[model samples]
Target: MSGPPPAAVTVHAPLRRRVTVQGVVQGVGFRPYVHALATALDLSGNVTNTPEGVVVEVEGDPAAVARFCDRIAVDAPPLARVDSVHHQEVPATGDSAFTILASRADGPTRALIPPDTATCAACLGELADPRDRRHRHPFVTCTHCGPRFTIVTGLPYDRDQTTMAGFPMCAGCAREYTDPADRRFHAQPVACPDCGPRLALLVRRADEAGQPSPVTDGDPIAAARRLLAGGAVLAVKGLGGYHLACDATDPAAVERLRHRKARGDKPFAVMAASVEDIEPLVRLDPEERALLTATTRPIVLLRRRTDGPTVPGGLRPAEGVAPGSPDFGIMLPYTPVHHLLFGLPGDPEGPRLLVMTSGNLSGEPIVTDDAEALERLAHLADAWLTHDRPIHVPCDDSVVRVCDGRPLLVRRARGYAPLPLPLPLEVRPALAVGGDLKNAFCLGAGRRAWLSAHIGDMDDLATQRAFERAVAQLESITPVRPRLLAADRHPAYRSARWAVRNAAGRPVVRVQHHHAHVAAAMAEHGLDGSVPVLGVAFDGTG
Candidate 1:
């Protein structure tokens, strides 16, 4: 009756496949994630990092292989960004176990590197646990967290290509690096105090042009805290660059830092030791709190608390912090060094909050070069709390605010950079030099677009050079060679001029401000001219 009783279903033979995953997969615990995924599916084969991206081979039941491919994209590591995944079936091999192989140089160069992440909770717990060998280690990092974009020198992110290359892992760390069950199995930045970057505190000499000398035979953290508590301004090196830090509660210190830096009434970003330290100062909603504690650890702009018990110094938000603004930029300690600055819990001597502003003269790039910092910041900083780790590229902290319960990015850099944004429409290999003011360039290939970390005003020579270097770095990772270029139409804009100068005979398209905004929105909404939609835009100048 039904049409010859439906044909019997057929079962397929065991299948094998090679999957190439693109996007921010390297340096992010991705190999271990793939290893775990393959083992769980009872698949056999291996995963490896390649210039193009992560490559995985699996042989198993046809269904299991299919699920492995699907889950790899869906259940990737938190920091892994799966842009485009391609898989093809191949002849099955009789492999018994899955393994993570050493990275290979041969392949397409489309792998994205992850941004530097804040210390993970597990690492923080280990830091606080006295029994852990790495307790209070300033460079404590596992596969789950720590430096990524800031420390990486090249693609196929490995220890050798990173700043950590200089520091060989200790025997204890070596075991964890090779242990598949360990959290730090292949973490590139994995290190202990025995082999890691060292910190030092240098006090500036009275002679303005003289080099600062190290404080004699004292704990650097303790010495730095003492200097800060005494209202001394310090140039503290951070993940990307140096930050001029001082006790936020000290009105005179804040004023001094502001005056010396030549900053005029600009609200400074504050780094609080913990949520408990800032809860009384800012009215944090659930969204704000999550943002404050997120792995990205961006400076979140929050409305100041109108009613609360004053902090130890009773420093009002409007008094010395955010002067006319209703909101204050607040960030929690993201690095172990930052946590150490406040001292261990139950210690009441250190400052609970610090004014963590970028270390630079007005209208200049943030200082990354140690020698440059010494020379440029001599007048502003009373001492320098720095380390031996070299910063490859200078990235400023990203700034964000919550609007209608969602994060609104004001400045995207550091923790949120080197990650691609999805493009609704496919475009040729192209580079878009953003506005000269905010100056965030974009590299596009196929359907993916990578916006670089915020590059400050292009008017400064150092910033322009930083922009070019950032573009080159992004190019190495994105594999998006620009056959076409786009830039703002403002004839006088420096970024536009840069685009023209660097086009290298490639076609350059000039786009108007409003037109570019509309087109971006259209692409984002997936409108391919088949339907019409109303759009509205408001510019700051308007």
Candidate 2:
């Protein structure tokens, strides 16, 4: 009736477009996604990773090309934040297939790196499945989740630029890494038990003159669990830095660690396997639960429960863990190592709750160097559960609390550093060295500002050196080149002194402490200062 399906008419002529997508696109499965998208649309072209961003060329029907451009940013991967997408029409290539090309490092690095994310659901399932090849693998990861900002040393987000460079992928891993259909395609940190980081348990031996020695017998995770159950303190290396962990239910262990670390009644954060495990100790509102389970995996502070279910076998959090505090800071396992430390299914029972705190003296930066951790934590931990992967940046755990059903950031580091905060107005490229107490600096250019991770106090030389390193690293990854420096007006403040020393001929702007606080509040609220507003600033120094 339709003239025998007359000659398969083309609704639109073939067209091509070159597309550029910016923001957190690299190291998060953007290329494979593009391949799948183009294949579905019957388009021909290629996708490539560049320091500037992702570049894609698609030649297909004009309507299909328009759809691709529209959906490129809208249907981006969960971890990939597409800030901008620009495309231009070009001559059609008349090709038949879409392909992913190797990463090119031939442009200025403008792509933003994503923060480290917790293990995704897929990887977790494989970890617990006995039939899976990655079962019980400590460093199991995929494109959807795993280390990002901490492991990355350069742009273009390739494996060779990460700490995993030394551990080449096995044939099995290589297959997954290359297969676009696989979840791990282009995952920079992808690995398996055959070729990846390995864990070792080092215990202090009396015969070895109190020096820690490797326990080559049995699984390191199992050995570490046994030590924890026996009221031992452990120095456990994590994605960011070292954490001093002990059984939270053991009153003796908690007191011992407090005394050793010189923590005087300051509350310690605790890590549990799930929300159910911590419900008896803290009140879990819906918002608090969400924050605890979020991919960021920050320590959520919750109100303490006065009367709750009884936990057997002395499994309750010790009073010494958070004495005189009405809230308890709790977080779930964010890494495979932490999950194994708490024991997986069919594994020997271990401590369900642990008091996890920064592995450092009372007021020093979190220890990242392996040898330094062993030396500095000798008196703090009875055993060392560490790996070979180097931590390029020392990021402490982030802390959050829900106030009025809204989350408030108490300390932003591991999960939320180097991410730009959109400013209400543009400003010249500048650096602001914060006060000496908290010592977090900011780098700003245009309408974005990036706050560095918590850099510790500036009272000691070690922290000063750490500050310099952090500044250098942050500058390398960001586009900000400070043309102006800002510091507090306190003449003798160590932070101010450091800013002046490193101004390098740039003018230093000294602002009053309280005035800076009020201005920051205004800026955070997106106030353009066109209207007068009353503000009250309160702080110990102010």
Candidate 3:
């Protein structure tokens, strides 16, 4: 208490206010955190994540009201990302204890879904503690990370709305999840090895005849690591989809993976066990290392190490590992599975490093289904490290780099895409059709713009399906019946075609590809075309 209340102080009557928070405020454990805070402060109100942002209505004692707004942000949940909040006073009606309300349509423009974050320091410490049940467990996760947009199927991110819906939580984990003081409180993805999703290995049943099928039932992650130890190739499912994995040190394994995947030219990314392991394979300046290790865990393109062998035809069939390029895309393991595969320092059968590449038949969307990955990647892979967790959204790994010392996003998936960007211009709540390659769409309202996770090249039918599903899902959360729609000028753009096909009830704006890009940059930098500035528009075929 900051001194007892003044004896003569007449506490003003409590007022009611409706608050709207914009930015990446959904699917990151925000509503529950607010509920907890409000309950503790004895406030009566509710908060919900609408397509626009989080909408809140609160009424309580004057001091509690101040604390409600002020402390909520400071003590915000670890995974929740708050950008800007707007609140307005309204009529007050008597109410009970504050609670989290189900998300409803508040305005146009979808709230940005926070990207998957890395495990928190606290959770990691617990994972490494032998006294803990999940000590050194590979699948350990908390509110900070594990999965978010990648695993969510709908809004109001609850366990039932996630891939974890199938496996019911064990009694102990469930208890911790409900305890207010516990870190796992209301944690949607919480589970122990006993009640959590299981792992299984998929191998080609008839080798040359059929697709891959799981041979072993339990612990596919651990089994896959054992196979990798023997220098075998295994296709593993990741946050977005499947990734082809092999021992990094085994040149034979790497080369084999390339030949099987029919990759003629395109560099395969290497996942060093740790930041220290990366130094030998590539040169990492202090800044580069910092970006690589950030919570985003983006694949970073770094100049290759002078010590490693140059691209050679004789090298493991990674034939196209580098085509028309000089940089190598490298990243540290972002998921708990990747962490477990490259076992911590003391674990036996620990792999010092591994080669992890997208699971696909070159030029295809990453694989998500166990049967499909086996059938599709059979030759390219020796075995499958499959899990029971179903992927709701298919996002690829996001890649980035420092060009001229500024961060440049390359792939824009896993931990970046789907997170809304702040825009300078507030359009009539609309959808900004993204480009054809690494295709991602943006929906917005007010100053906030939500970008969908990377949708991959529009050429593949699978990618097209993903694009359609993504659009519907975003529309559900950001509830926008855009009075006006926007698309690219290019006639061949699948996105443009989609816009044309879907514009049954609205006005359509066909913006040139580069124009939208420039406009987006301008919006982000707060530029209002008062002064002329140099701009470059590049298109090879146009």
Which residue pairs show backbone clashes in model 1? 52-108
Provide the lDDT at 453 for model 2.
Answer: 88
Candidate 1 lDDT over residue span 346-465, tens digit each: 555788889999888766678888888898888889999998888886788999999899898888887988777777777899999988776788998888788887777788888888
What C-alpha lDDT, on a 0 to 100 scale, does residue 122 get in candidate 1?
Answer: 92
lDDT per model, in order?
A: 0.85, 0.90, 0.74
lDDT of 3 by residue, 477-539 (tens): 564546667888888888788888888877779987777776766776787667675667665
How does residue 171 of candidate 1 score in lDDT? 93
Residue 245, model 1, lDDT: 96
- Candidate 1 yields a Cα-based lDDT of 0.85
Q: Quick one: ranking by lDDT, best first?
A: 2, 1, 3
TM-score of 1: 0.90
Mark the 10 consecutive residues where model 2 has the least summed lDDT.
1-10
Task: Name the lDDT value of residue 404 in candidate 3.
Answer: 75
Q: Which candidate is the best by lDDT?
A: 2
